[model samples]
Target: MRLMPDEHQVRSLDHQWQLGNTRGQMRTWGRGQFRWTTFDLSVERGPDGKRRIKKTTLTDTADLKNPLRDAVLAMGWSWRARLSKL
Candidate 1:
């Protein structure tokens, strides 16, 4: 499936892509004191013959900082951290 974003968003994405920030690395964003992980963008040709985001696949570093666990804890869940968990 193809994903579309507005021109402003596309410009931001293009800027990131051009800077090589989205290359072989998982993007991170800060939420309060926690850093959250995000997927890498994959591009593909759309039906209209235009390039678009095909999918967002999670990177192998999902567990690097335990973002998922932090999210669960933030939601007041009784969770335990496991080794190499995603």
Candidate 2:
């Protein structure tokens, strides 16, 4: 996926979007409607005093692919993904 950084946000053709200090969302079409999966993002300091980004998926996504995680890793940031029960 070719993600273009627009200011503090990154967007791709697949409709993956991310904003600063805010939740991100992925949109997919299914069952004659749009399905949305949200991601909660946070930045924290790691044990080494470096910044780490935490991304938590808030809902079950219709698609199995995770472009956001791939994008974050591509940016060379310390990141992790978590699955939320909610």
Candidate 3:
């Protein structure tokens, strides 16, 4: 795996991702289509003193790119919205 950084971590998320374990296939649901997929993420602490997510879930497994960015962004923004009050 290549070393990289999470803007939130001030640390590298590349370690969270690896070339290995790229074989765990699961399921993917999109636009009424469900298919096999895999998980490729892990949760860890970031420099922000909060849970920093380095994709914290499956990325790409079936040699296809993970296609949940918009949904993830929605949740991310929602999380931030909740945190904004604190």
Candidate 4:
């Protein structure tokens, strides 16, 4: 069987969450009208004291809402907490 890479989109009513590496640790689901190429990765503690992650998409950067309304804004926030650090 042929194989293909997973896919994701920005839209409303979409809830994406994952934890992995830059190889394929992206969760994108929602609505919007922006074109994104990729998302940058970084390690930062969240306000919840859970040692959460911080995503910075290559395009959007205004606000993040599942099922996003703007492609650029849909940057990255896959509901994931952190990568496996393996």
Top candidate by lDDT: 2
**Residue-level error in angstroms, candidate 4, position 51:** 1.1
Listed in order, each prediction's TM-score against the native is 0.27, 0.31, 0.22, 0.25
Error of 2 at 77 (Å): 46
In candidate 2, what are the lDDT values of residues 1-86, reduced to their tens digit? 23344433333233334344435445333222234788999999999999999999988554644666566668764333222211
**Comparing candidate 2 with candidate 4, which one achieves the higher TM-score?**
2
Which has the higher lDDT value, candidate number 2 or candidate number 4?
Answer: 2
- Which residue pairs come into collision in candidate 3? 26-37, 39-58, 40-58
lDDT for residue 66 in candidate 4, whole number 0-100: 29
Best by TM-score: 2
Q: Which ten residues in a row have the lowest lDDT in candidate 2?
A: 77-86
Clashes of 4: 10
Could you give candidate 3's per-residue lDDT for residues 1-86 as a string of tens digits? Answer: 11123422111111122243458554342232223456566678888888865753454432431333234445442112111112
Lowest-sum lDDT 10-residue window in model 1? 7-16
For model 4, the superposed segments whose C-alpha errors exceed 4 Å read 1-36, 60-86
Q: Against the correct fold, how does model 4 do in TM-score?
A: 0.25
**Which pairs clash (backbone N, Cα, C closer than 3 Å) in model 1?**
none
- The candidate 3 region of ten consecutive residues with least summed lDDT is 8-17
